[model samples]
Target: MEPRFLLLSDVAAELNVSDSQVYHMVRSGELPAIKIGGRGQWRVERARLEEYIAAKYAETAAWVAKNPLVDREDEA
Candidate 1:
């Protein structure tokens, strides 16, 4: 079974991004995460990660819809 929470490295690996990038996202509150243990290690909830991905997909779709691709033939 999949884990309920994931380490920052795991999240970074899944997103194909750097660990620092994920850390920054968490710091910026763009991606929800929690600090645990005496060492204050970061962990992201599985459900929250899924929600973040879905939100990104929706955000990208909105951008694409707003900025329609123009046909190059019209310029030629």
Candidate 2:
């Protein structure tokens, strides 16, 4: 079975990003995460990570719609 929560490194690996980037996202509140244990290490719920990915997809779609790519051929 899949784990219910993931470490920052695991999340980063899944997203193909750096662990520090994931930490920053959690710190900035751009991504949802929870601190556990006495050391307060961060953990992201699998469902929340999925939600974040879906939200980014929608955000990117909106941005692409607003800023349609210009064909380089048309620039000449």
Candidate 3:
């Protein structure tokens, strides 16, 4: 079966970003994560990560609505 959780590096790879950036997002509470390691390692739930990505897409759509582009320069 596929894993239900992923390491910080795995998440970073999935998002195509640096591991540090993923850490920052988790630290900032933008992305949900859990600290389960005895040495304090972090892990992310696959469902939560998918939710975060979907939220970003929603946010981008909202931004587009707020700042629409004209079909032609002359129409602006």
Candidate RMSDs in order: 0.7, 0.8, 1.6
Looking at candidate 2, the ten consecutive residues that score lowest on lDDT are 27-36
**Backbone clash tally for model 2?**
0
Error of 2 at 5 (Å): 0.5
Q: Which stretches of candidate 1 lie over 4 Å from their true place?
A: none
Give lDDT: candidate 1, residue 8.
Answer: 96
- Tell me how candidate 1 scores on lDDT: 0.99
Candidate 3 clashing pairs, residues 3+ apart or interchain: none
lDDT of 1 by residue, 1-76 (tens): 9999999999999999999999999999999999999999999999999999999999999999999999999878
Model 2: per-residue Cα lDDT over 44-70, one tens digit each? 999999999999999999999999999
Winner on TM-score (1 vs 3): 1
lDDT of 3: 0.95
Ranking by TM-score: 1, 2, 3
As for candidate 1, its clashing pairs are: none
Q: Please state the error at residue 23 of candidate 1 in Å.
A: 0.5
Best by TM-score, which number? 1
